[model samples]
Target: MTAFTAWQVWGRFVVNDSPSWTEPASVLMMGWFILLGSAVGVREGYHLGFDILVVVLPETPRRVLVTISDIAVTGFGGAMAWYGYQLAAGTWNNVSPALKIPVGISYTPLIVGGVLIVLFSLERILRRLAGLPEPHLEADPADSVA
Candidate 1:
């Protein structure tokens, strides 16, 4: 994607002949990157959240809240996957203006990433139920500065 952007910039400024395909291609690539990155964040328990409440809650309440949150995430991911499939299917016949590729291709990442989130969240929930240790996201204490 960076290569495409560089080529686009060089061609426009130096060669005076910018390629129309670069913009749309870069956008497609970025969309895939963001969707997949979000899935990875969920898998690693690195997604953004307000942890103050969870931290203050007692252990039992915290566990219940965590379980509820996980179930919600699982449901959301499932919905995304299902609706994304419908969206991709509906747009399969449509082509992009510049790239001329099927527009449905753009939605592929949503379906893939959503399914991955569902799997990862389900795994986390299972581990919690089985009394496995919860994954921690704390940074090393030594790494902190005064």
Candidate 2:
């Protein structure tokens, strides 16, 4: 996201005869996807949860359920990483208009975010197994519900 923004900024600079962007803007843009996913997690406490029945359960069961749910979520991330890589690799030749970069570059976020989700899920699972507190999967009081 930031990369795209930077691209636009650099594009303007190029037009205005200012210094051109030096660093690879795509890398910066890719970071935005990861940041976006993290923001989602932070906003919701966790991104993976069984929200349907959780509201009716007591805290204990709800925590246990969420922990269990995270395992599946992490596995899903793994699957996404695997499939996303294949998809990206398969479409690497296709280019975008603004960036003229490979279409696969956009999917980098999916791969990276999937890995991050897996790591977070593992952390949550370990915390659960170690009897540490499970992280909240709900938004803060002030945040709108997902």
Candidate 3:
């Protein structure tokens, strides 16, 4: 995305006319970036949440609430995968005008992100069940995969 954006800028400023594919490519890359980032956020529990209730709850109730929250996230991931599949399938035959790629390819990240979210949420739940430490809201930078 950055490369495309830079190319777009250089083209427009230096060449007077931008490459047609750069804008669309950057937009498509942005969609992928958001989806992938969101899935990783779920894995790291990095997304913002209203934590006042959980913070005030007793340990047991807080655990229960956390479990419920994880369940809800899993459900949301499932919905994303299902709906994304439908959307992608519906648009599979349509090609993007700028990139000449199947438009459906743009939506493929949703399915991937959804699956990742579900997996990560399930891991959290399983860890809780196993009496292991649950994932922290923010992962240690050194502990994260590159």
Candidate 4:
């Protein structure tokens, strides 16, 4: 993607004409990067969690809350996958102006990311239930302020 963008800039600045495909191609690349990165974040527990309640709660309730949160995220992932599938199928015929590819290809990342998120979240929940070690989680932001 970086190389493509550089080509775009070079084409515009040096050649006096930007490649028409670059902009749409870059946008598609950005969407894939962001969506897939977020799925990886789920696996790594990099997303923020409001754990103030969990910190103060009793062990039982804390576990309960955590399980519930994971379940909710799983449901959200399902929704994303379902809707994304619909969008992709619905737009499969629409061709990208510059890339000449089906516009639906751009939405495919949503489905991939959603499925990954669902799998990762379920793995966390199962590991928690089985008393396995937790996933890798980022440290709290407040801890670094010193």
Candidate 5:
């Protein structure tokens, strides 16, 4: 994506003939990147949330709240997958102006990411039920910059 943006800038400023395809291509790529990145975040328990309340709760209540949260996430993921499929299917015949690719291609990431979220959430619930360690919310020390 960076390379595409750089090429776009260079083409416009240096070559004086910017390609029309670059903008739409970048938009499509960014959509995929965001959706997939969100799925990875869900799997890693890295998604944003307010944990202050949960953190203050007692152990049993915390467990219950976590379970409830996981169930909610699973439901949300399922809904996204279903609606994303409908959207993709509905726009399958529509083509982009510049790339001429089917408009549905841009929505594929949503469906895939939704499915991944569902799978990951289910695994988390299962782990919780099996008495496995709770997923940590702490940021990785390695992510810290000097």
Candidate 6:
């Protein structure tokens, strides 16, 4: 939906300035940005507990901090998923902007993304508990795969 609208806007730009196309295009761009931000862990990295503080800590403190962080993130995800599901389901009757699409449909991403983060946090927590190496959010470009 967003991609199609973006294409439509691009086409409009190629032609002449049409308010109809521009309006939806702007809206689509905003939605796309929000979706992309929510889908990836990038946004989470910038939030509460994620930072360079852990990097300077001793190994024991670092491990403890990361474990605590994982638990907190998992809890956050659980709450978001639960409340988001309720919001989506309870507000299913509301109409959206643009195409009058159901507002609940827009909230589907919140549930999905929250669930995904929960899953990721669980895996990380398990890894920490098992004394395995921590997974970096981004792989080093020069690291060899084996």
- RMSD (Cα, Å) for all candidates, in order, is 2.6, 6.1, 5.7, 3.0, 4.0, 5.6
Using all chains and alpha carbons, the TM-scores for the candidates as numbered come to 0.87, 0.60, 0.86, 0.87, 0.87, 0.66
lDDT over C-alpha atoms for residue 140 of model 2? 49
Q: How do the residues 56-97 of candidate 5 rate in per-residue lDDT, one tens digit apiece?
A: 677778778777887888888888888999999999999988
Q: Which of candidates 5 and 6 reaches a greater TM-score?
A: 5
Against the true structure, candidate 3 reaches a TM-score of: 0.86
Candidate 1, run of 10 with poorest lDDT: 135-144
Q: Clash number for model 6? A: 0
The lDDT of model 5 is: 0.82
46-139: candidate 2 lDDT, tens digit per residue? 5646886786688789877877788788888788778878878988999765556897876777777777777777877777678775446443
lDDT of each: 0.84, 0.68, 0.82, 0.84, 0.82, 0.66
| Per-residue lDDT of candidate 3, residues 37-145 (tens digit) | 9989878776544355665667677778888888988999889988898999999999999999999988888888888889988987898788786546323578656
Q: What's model 6's overall lDDT?
A: 0.66
Cα-based lDDT at residue 139, candidate 4: 42
Model 6 spans with C-alpha error above 4 angstroms? 1-39, 42-50, 135-146
lDDT of 1 by residue, 1-146 (tens): 99999999999999999999998899889988998898888787766543556666777777787778778888888998999999999999999889988999988888998999899889878987898876463344775678
Model 4, 1-146: lDDT tens digits are: 99899999999999999999988888999998998998888787665554667666676787787788888878888888889999999999999889999989999999999999899889989988998865343245676657
Worst 10 residues of 2 by lDDT: 17-26
Residue-wise lDDT of candidate 6 within 25-74, one digit each (tens)?
45645654664465366234443564476766777887788778878878
Off-target runs (Cα >4 Å) in candidate 3 are 48-50, 135-146
Candidate 4 residue 126 C-alpha distance from true site, Å: 0.8
Candidate 2: misplaced stretches above 4 Å? 1-31, 38-44, 51-60, 135-146
